[model samples]
Target: MTKEHILPKWMREEFPELAREPVFQGSQNEHDGPTPDGPRTVYRGGKEESGPFNRQAPVVCGPCNNGWMSQLETNVHEPLSRMIRGLPTVLTSERQAVVALWSAKTLMVAYRAPHFGPRPRPEVILPVDAERLYQDRALGPMMVMGLANYQPTPYAREPLYVQSFTRMEHEGGAYSYCATLRIGHFAAQLVRCPDGMYPPLGQIPPHLVLLRPGASAVHWPPSRPIRAGAEWDSFVNLPEETGT
Candidate 1:
């Protein structure tokens, strides 16, 4: 009944990969992709340290095709009921509200302004309702969906990618959840490049963000009045008994 549980649908569908990757907020706040021939100089704690010099580096100076930048393209107001009508599972209208709210909130967080350089430039323009994402209590909450090991861009240290419980952003402050990643593996570039530098668009290592790793890891949550995970039914099981 508290604010955190009242999220919308956009949050779910858009930020579906939440708590799946190693998410870093301002570490790479520079979403302005660099020119293809660009050379990035990162300091690994001084001492004449250096990292990979990929001309493929993106610039935080301007918006690029990073998937995170496509937030504005998502249909936030779309009804989850209509989206899930064909499913065999059962959900309530009130729960549907929760599902939609969750989804909306997810998308907003995903669409949240991608790191812009020293100025005001958002790589991901965010949903059309940018104002509402932050203002709406149901959508106000935010969470960083990533594996602890998922390294943040521009940082030399490799993310632990270990399973752990982190804070969830809501109106009140932060909340904790027992989360683990289910995205076993993906056809990502799999480059062993030293830390930082992830694709700005689409699921790079497109994997699952499970509620619990190993045991009950899955793509969706249990059905209430609203539903999610059904979106991932094709990839993971969405049986009501399965909790989605």
Candidate 2:
């Protein structure tokens, strides 16, 4: 397995001011409550239970994890981190593609976490498949990606969030998988199944301020005015399926 730094090096490089800030990682804590099925591990930010928490995930293979995946991180880190830090920036269509690739990579690693709970069973796509997918510039029919914004509460501690989830879909499908990675108040949503298979995250609780990349424009510090039918919108108003 390869060593993966949860917080990519580009984070500090892009935002030098935050270089000295403490970075927190999520750790899988022991399963506590009894469940009908069995015990499942609990998840908490590493800072919650320990003094020093190194941000690392060592389960991915070296070549695949460090090579192409690392490249993806490098390409997207600046824009994604800026989005997370609530900094002013614009995400072009190409930039959006990079962010989607990085988001998928992050979700794949998080899937290895013991406490990551149940998700829609993912299709096994090998490293070679990744190259093929990348070249094609698509995550296939099973995956969908979108962006969103939110205003963080004063007490919010974690700047990043990564997890997988499933929904009882609108159709007959019982488990439609979805994954999300949020940095600061910006998030990239990836659904591993087709639209209409499940209700989109925007349609659910904690509705998000969704971002439409090509159709809309993004300006940080929310006070900046965005044009009508643009990138930023209430989830309820967006199309059911919007992503590359």
Candidate 3:
């Protein structure tokens, strides 16, 4: 297997400010259980760390890393750079697809990274999902994507940050896998659910520009912005009932 950088090299070179800044990686697992008042979420063990933003995981094969994955990064370089810099730009339906695909790929790589502690951490994206992604090189219908502008407070700003979580519904045996990624002013979230299951409507914050298969062009800097710190924390950690 070849080592792949979770945060692409181009990103670091383009925004040199991020080269030395620490990146915080964290994961949480939420479960539905009975509480005195009602059913509540039981959060279990999780890991958190702050270290150099440049991280690599030896999880991808040489062909995949050098072939399609590299192409995907190339395809998104220009548009994503603009968005991360908070520059004005329009994301047409086509561009949205590329961004969504790249987001999914990144999330998958992050999930496989060693920072999450060890095995048996909640599995959000299934093995089959990753295989399908590799074969199709596109987002499947089971995945939903959204993008938004992040307004970080001076004290909380970081070059890169990611939070991943899985929500389990005991009654229905349903699972939701989600990850929120932020790079400078650009933020995106991807949710994956089983067939016939959908993410709760309330799970998504209203300010995001939902990226769909055939949707129209979306303007940058959505009307509502996610303020860093509390708002961002809340967005990354969804409520128990929201199915993330």
Best by lDDT: 3
lDDT of each: 0.25, 0.49, 0.74
lDDT of 3 by residue, 1-244 (tens): 9989988888777877667666666666666555634665455435454544557888899999999889989989998999888887788888888898999888888878776666444555577877888888877767788888888777755546555555444345666666788877888888777567765546545678787646789888788889877888777765656433
lDDT of 1 by residue, 1-244 (tens): 1112112334345345442334222211121124433543221111111111101212212331223223322322333323322223222434333433444443333223222123112222223344554345232223223211121233353221211111111122211221222211210011011113222234423342211112322232222211122322222211111101
lDDT of 3: 0.74
User: lDDT score, residue 14, model 2?
Assistant: 56
lDDT by residue for model 2 over 81-180, one digit each (tens)?
7777666677666676676667766655555543333322233223443454556644654556666664545464533443323222222322243455
Ranking by TM-score: 3, 2, 1
Candidate 3 segments whose C-alpha is farther than 4 A from its true place: 34-41, 44-53, 119-121, 155-159, 198-206, 242-244
Q: Model 3 compared with the native: what TM-score?
A: 0.86
Q: After superposition, how far is residue 166 of candidate 1 from its true place, in Å?
A: 26
Model 2 spans > 4 angstroms off = 12-53, 114-137, 155-164, 167-174, 194-244
Q: Give the TM-scores of the predictions, in the order they appear.
A: 0.21, 0.57, 0.86
Q: Which candidate, 2 or 3, would have the higher lDDT against the true structure?
A: 3
